[model samples]
Target: MSGHGEAQPMKSRKSGPLRGVAEVPGDKSISHRSLIFGAMAVGETRITGLLEGQDVLDTAKAMRAFGATVTRLGEGAWTVNGVGVGGFREPEDVIDCGNSGTGVRLIMGTMATAPITATFTGDASLRKRPMGRVTDPLALFGARAYGRQGGRLPMTVVGAANPVPVRYALPVASAQVKSAVLLAGLNAPGETVVIEKEPTRDHSERMLLGFGARLSVEKTGEGHVITLTGQPELRPQTVAVPRDPSSAAFPVCAALIVEGSDITVPGVSQNLTRNGLYLTLVEMGAEIDFLNPREEGGEPVADLRVRFSGEMKGIEVPPERAPSMIDEYPVLSVVAAFATGKTVMRGVKELRVKESDRIDAMARGLEACGVRIEEDEDTLIVHGMGPGGVPGGATCATHIDHRIAMSFLVCGLAAKAEIAVDDGSPIQTSFPVFLPLMNGLGASLTAG
Candidate 1:
């Protein structure tokens, strides 16, 4: 099983103006997919700039457990020698995916039609997250899943001996669920179609095509129609991942509120599906420039130049945009605390099921920091005090969620007093270099 280990509590103090360029790790979404898709290809797939966080590394281990030969050539460089479709071998022991929902969920789909029975478990966080979302779609492919109450983790997936392709419409806007179904369809017969009323991240669709799978996506009145032909011979190719825009939210928001701060984030993924946070920030009066727009790995990539801007006014985030920036609301809430008026975010009930109840988590932490916040089942309203109006000096519990931890640390960058997170260890799961990267940019941080 994956280890949670001891909690490491850390504190952050109010910092001076932050300046410098930040190069965050590769996109976590793309990293997990790269390892999984690479493991599913016929020949060796070499990858550069893969995120080496625990979540992604666990995916790499899970790929190996399923019989792929994955090797780390050096830092951020790995190679996967795949065993194509329907070629996975059932593991002798349980597969522990640690804190990665993406790792375990996608891996479950990978094995759902391989005539294998694989038991999947994760850390406390992942085990608590509902697995029914992914399993329900896999069931259409003749996969059976038996797990704890409420279809949570410590679950076992019994693959279909004679799998058939399925056409599933996504019930929710979840990239994980969408990706899981597409992966299970790989070994199923015939074409698998998935229609999502709301578009989620298209990494799976993009990566599948890049790996030599025959797939097509079209937008109709209903939503996005994605069709994939199963059992194709996937060929390996080199992959270069772009920097994660999600992780860049921290520094970008910190610079926006720190007064006179300016920062640069280079080579970030500008894929429309994943750039919602940047769009939301811009809506909140952020001055961010998309520099040197170019294409890398078939996805749009750009450099972001952001500067301190205190004239930001709160704006209601259109609910439809939530799917694109779902992972960024926590930090976006921090930015809202510095803006004028209320920032209303709707269509975000998805925040409730993340690593933690993020809406509740951020609401409590922000209120403790003397910021006014109103939250219900599906919306979070953060009343901004504008710059220099936030009161700090609260010890916030991160709920073992990486976003909550990082969001609060960014809060301290502009708060009047020091802010502390109960544990900083969770940051390792996604952005292991977060601390040094922030400090190098002139933000003062001290470990506890």
Candidate 2:
């Protein structure tokens, strides 16, 4: 019953060139994993740079309910005293993951093999999302999940006393489904194998290895095959989460499209598996440089310096790079509106099932702003405006999605006329400091 808060409606106006350095929050995927892994470890796990967003905070609370001692030391610092692997106690209350699909899905997998029953629910947006993608896989692990129609939330998961390990070939490219199976396999006997035809975010696999779980990744001719040895005694370690590249996309794209703008974003994760947007932008003739590239927390880190570019040419984004930059498509579409030629993005059927129909959202909003776009079942093509050619007197409908709201706001920065969005309140789910941070960087955003 934790998702009792009502949605608030808000709007945003046109802005100017976003300037100065921006320090985005820690990666959301890593933050959620740190808490879950820490809860399952034998000893204390220290975490630094954890995202303090509402979604992540809800996960922290859920961990505590499952008998783990989670404490917040200070800003971006947390500690979890774990209950040991395969040793979760039945929660006395329901688990509420708020608006985080990552949180609820992974937690379901973590608790699905422990011989306990737990009810899970979330906010309106999360409740509407299909949990069938995760529950269907968990069912193969001997867990019983019963939810509302279409496998939506407000569901109950009954863990199996003796779970069976499974070798699941993902039907689609979904990191959540992949991570769920891996987490459930940690308590089963024998090896749990997952074959992903298209590589998604490998945060769960990477973090599992970091936590001393017996996990390995091998690339097969067909796809990436990941095998995890079950029932290992996991050891806790200190974790430093990397800055989110998805959140960094807004400022980076804004600087590239806004005239007379130069900005630097430090400590951004440049994992080849997650930097597709930057690579695609470079191919579009953006003036961006990777400065002082180094490693941080076992991930590639770099300082991104972006300057205003007046001559951007659109390029066809390959399907192979979809997993690397799935969350960035909304912002990328915004950038494409200012580029010359057509930007074609294919093999993105996953967009239909995100927080909202991201393809329809971007296509509708961009069209209102005088940008031509077309969409099929799994493809989107944008006809660009060639350098400052956008006539952006429009109001976009956000449908309670944070990325949709933020992407349209960035479009307003370089537009000839002011732009507006129906709702900006959803920004708190991920980047709560977005408006103030961008305003500090000299962007003229006002709450209308």
Candidate 3:
């Protein structure tokens, strides 16, 4: 994906009313899971509304490498013919997940108990992320791994010849880590038990049930206990992926900050575990209408009507809410920059290990744009100067992370001067249509 040229720095300026309908791409999490679970099932799985981003596409290619038949039928429509449980063939080529930690980690777990070996690699940003969180739990199912000294990638995974299930209590609240262990449990001998003190996204658990696997969750005094029966015949499914709330955050935050703007984002996921940013926006005095709330393919969906407001005031985001909005803190910080007071976000040490240390990336970039920010290992505090008060003349280095690149671009759309990102090329890894969508909504974005 780094093939996207970096010579083209992206710039954005103060915008007019951002009016348009934005249909962001499919959920990256669901897109990767649908293809992965499909590849492990017994029959053909047809998927619609798939995110065609490089991250998910790299996952699709990995499925093919494991001897599954994957094909693209049309835009957002894909076919996956699975190899069934415990039937994976050893891949001849290495799997390059291309900047997707989710894709590489989850795929490693999917093949962990299948008596096969595969090596995984990714782009520069992803290579620096810690894979030990995933590889640690996977080893419990008898899988073995050898990578860089710090457990970084260009790694080799050897699947278990005979896996025995074990009960695990999550050390960190990460959907990727939780899902990796569960996927590895697929071919283990007995029931696999996972206990989480705090809840993360449950797409893997929900999809397992939908695909005819025996799974159950019970909330007890300790935590949420998830039990999965291993070695079941995984049935294929017709998956209709929901639009991503993460991608929708860009437009929704943009409309809130730009003066006199009113915009609607259609068919976005409203799952409680993923809507923390929207809820925080409402608390900050945003007038967003969740029109026509309904369910699509077993997930909550809604049309978001966002209107620009200059009266927004920042509020403290509690530690308990961090897991739900972890991926959103970068852009949420941008929204806070345009609000009227201080926005405090804590319990996000997890942000330190993302594609980049997001707190460091945003704090430095925001300071460069003449906005005040405070940060530590677990908290990010943005001191807002109100809408149109920010003097945005600085150019930000994206650190090759998509969220960092997009957050600064949104900052430029309301600041007194233009904001520039050193490289917008990484934006394609998630929301490929970001620029066109922003431009369509009346934002001033120039590609150099």
Candidate 4:
């Protein structure tokens, strides 16, 4: 979370080829769902390979506040002894989720129908995020939310004493919002249904089924309709989380740009909903080999052998594919800067509401680094400069966004000069060991 410590300004410079294996941390999405669903189950749910990042850790803390027994046994091993459905206790103090939007939103939903009142707050970045998107849909289940103007954090949610099931459609394509509604429906009577025009990550749906909930998805003329039978006996699970593709993107993309670099990233999730960046890279003629494709934890997994590509040309990223790769766009733009043609990304207005306005942040940061860029409300076009073409002498403002900070650091690895970020501390929210992990792989990074 921002301001928890001093601002960590960091810088990176051109380096030699990055080698060796990069075993990135576990999936953040799955890590959050595992703890939430584990808290809703009736018995002890043991989890391995949980991402220990601050964001997921915040979720674990919230689960404990809601009367669940969350214990960390080892490096990434944890056990959550749930309180069962409708069994959450009113927390004695305010629930501070740090900088995690996922933690607060999903926890709100989990406690919404349990006759508990929880006050939620976060850091500077998290406080600015709009919570109404989640609180609005939660109201349909007979829950009441009172927050600051625009439905921000420092909010209180009063759980329904006599909750009822709801049938609602999403106003936007957000996995957080979708998962929040599904979690809220866990304690309501009868069936709670949610319809979405575009499918986001389905970790919550898959984990719900794994926890023995009656859930189904149907394709109709309107969209994808998801129905969940409320008040089921959630069973405990032994979950083994897959490696995060989003974290893998950093090392994988860094290898593609740095000359003569070849690296292996093991156990990355190849879930179709999260592989748009890899698909786009393949279209750009990247030399990536997906080796040993298999399934782990109900999701596809792969070991990627990434090699530097001397010949790469940017292509138009499909607008329909935005939901799958929303988090990867900032880094994808860095890759585009090293390509030979223009990379056009449309249907990305959602970037405006992230930790920062990512589109504007990335555009401004890249331009300062001597890369030409253009943007509108819903589109970002990067005019590529080919390999080693960017001058890269400016300091990019991270705006307390992890991806933006990491993206510019990646940009510096292949640029002519050095690149700097105003704040690198936010990277801990998702990838806590980013600097050490990259530095271990031969990156020239320093505390600025």
Candidate 5:
């Protein structure tokens, strides 16, 4: 099982201007998919710029357990000798996905149509999360799942001996759920279709096409209808992952609030589905320039030049943009505290089911830092304290959420007093180099 060791309390203090280039880690979403898809291909698939965080690493381990020979060549380079689709071997031991909900959920779908039985578990934080979202759909393909009540982990999946294709319409907006159904569809016999009322991230669809799957997406009056012809001989290809915009959000947002800060983030994915935070920031009067926009790894990429602006004003984030920026609201809330007026985030009921109840977590933490906030089941309204208005002498509970940990740390860099997180260890799950990267950019962060 993956372990973060002990609680490492960390604090951040008001710092001077931050100026530098922040090359954040590879995209976490793409990293996990690369390993999974590679393992499903027929030949060796090589990947570069893969995120080496715990979540992606756990996915790599799970791929190996399913009979793929996944190896790290060095740094961010990896090679996977796939067992091909419908060829996964039953694992000899329990699959411990650690703190990764993405890893376990996607893997469950990948093996759902094969004639194998596998049990999955994770860390305390991941185990508390609901897995029913994925399992409920998998049942349509003749997969049987039995776990603790409420569909928690330490669960076993009995793959279907005679699996059939399914047509599932998303009950909610979730990339994880959408990806799982698409993966399971790869093993069933006919064309499997999935309908989404709202378009989620299309990484799975894009990657599946890149790997030579017969898939097509159509947009009708009822939303996006995705059809995948099941059981293709997936071809292996070299994958180069773009830098993560989600991980880049920390430094990009930190620069927006810290007076005199100027920083550039290079090669970050500007995928339309993932750039909602950037759009929202620009709407608030943030001085960010999208430089040298181009394509990389089948996705749009760009360089971001951000400068500290004291004139930012909050705006209501459209509810439709929620699926694209769900993982970013915590840090966006931090930026809101430094802007003028209220920044309202709606259609974010999904925030309540992430690594933690993010709405409650950020609300309490911001409130403790002397920032007025209002939140209900589906909305969060952060009344901005304006430039340098946050008086931040408080210790915020991390709740084992990586984004929550990094968001509060960024908050301290501009607050009047220091801000501390009760446990910073969770940051390793996604952005392992978060501290060094921010500190190198002149932010004041320390662990004790």
Candidate 6:
């Protein structure tokens, strides 16, 4: 595996507090959904501020393969002319989703209820992630999937000819799984219901409704109960995707941990389902506040004013909030190292099967940097070293995971010594301007 490509090492040195405005790109989840929904709509869908990340780009390509006329107009602007509901054409070639689990899983769900046969594959890191969670639920819609051992990638999905709607209770807090089933239900008859034991990001549900799909969401004792009516003529509409809070976490955390730093990240999605990390950080006494709370693209958003907080105290993150902040645990762990006391994250076993074994990767990397941590199958406990107490002479192993590489780079800012990572190229998957943005904020990151 090491010989497949030349390894690049990058190092980061201690820096003063990060200060400036961070205008992060659009939300990744929403960007992906916009393309998928646009492809299934009856007319042209125009989108602005779309995240031009590799993951979202892969979804755009998949939409084009399904006969949608996807066109890039300019920076952060795209248009998709749909083939209408139940009008997807059978692709003659494989659907390669690259390194995006979201792209593959959600696309698989969308194609499952149709009468098409498609094969899915991805990069080395994405292929290692589990697909069983998606395939198991999709089987209820009369779809058939066959994959390698352990439900790894390079799989073929045979869609349902006569699909049946299903009511599924999510075993884990995953927006991708929920979105997949919901997308599959668009071509099926009758109503499809999904119950979440814990709330995840609701971008899929909200965007479906925005595109004129018949979708409703209600809070129930069991969890969030979502219902979708099938075979509706989805009318396309213009979409303005908000800045991703998950991507915003990197710069926000860096500013909070670094000394004498103050920054503002504008137009961040503050959707209640996705602000759990910022809430946890505020509870830990970080100097974060919302400015100009407003609505955009039918979602709640805010401009976050973050400043350096040296007296952060760690706190237990409620397990119920996992779905809202699932993609942020890696950056949260980096921030935790600078806090006092212990930060405990529970009910996150799903982290084990992401692009990398996130729990193991974070635990090992933190330990290597002279911070203490304990982990199990579903929980991670970090004994924070307080502000500026981290001894960071270690070179962290990123294991080809983008978040891991970025997280370690954030840790090096307030650490006593410099920190290094095995590779930094994967950061382009989501935040391509990460290093330049951080460097502009006075971070000393160097490529070797």
Give a tens-digit lDDT track for model 2, residues 197-302. Answer: 9888899998999999999899989799999999998899899999999999999999999888899999888898799999999999999999999988778999
Residues 269-343, candidate 3, lDDT per residue (tens digit)? 889888899899999999899999999867999999999988999899978888888899999999999999999
- Tell me the tens digit of each residue's lDDT in model 1 across 1-448: 3667788887888888899999999999999999999989999999999999999988898899899999999999999999998889998889999988889989999999899999999988888999999999999899999999999989999999999999999999999999999999999989999999988899999999999999999899989999999999999979998888899988999999998999999988889898898988888789999999999877899999999988998999999999889999999999999999999999899999998999999999999999998988999999999997899899999988999999999999899999999988889999999999999999877668
Q: Supply candidate 6's per-residue lDDT for 293.
A: 97
Best by lDDT: 5
**TM-score result, candidate 5:** 0.99
The whole-model lDDT of each prediction reads: 0.92, 0.90, 0.92, 0.92, 0.94, 0.90
Q: What is the lDDT for 64 in model 6?
A: 91
TM-score, every prediction: 0.99, 0.97, 0.99, 0.98, 0.99, 0.97
Q: Model 6: per-residue lDDT, tens digit, 52-88?
A: 9888888999999989999999998999999887788
What C-alpha lDDT does candidate 4 achieve relative to the native structure?
Answer: 0.92
lDDT of 4 by residue, 94-197 (tens): 89888787788889989999898999998888889999999999999989999998998899999998999999899999999999999999999899999999
Q: Which residue runs of candidate 6 sit more than 4 Å off their true CA positions?
A: 1-7
Candidate 3's C-alpha lDDT? 0.92
**Shift in Å, residue 297, candidate 2:** 1.5
Decoy 4 TM-score against native: 0.98
Candidate 3 residues lying further than 4 Å off, grouped into runs, are 1-7
Clashes of 4: 0
RMSD of every prediction: 0.8, 1.5, 1.0, 1.0, 0.7, 1.8
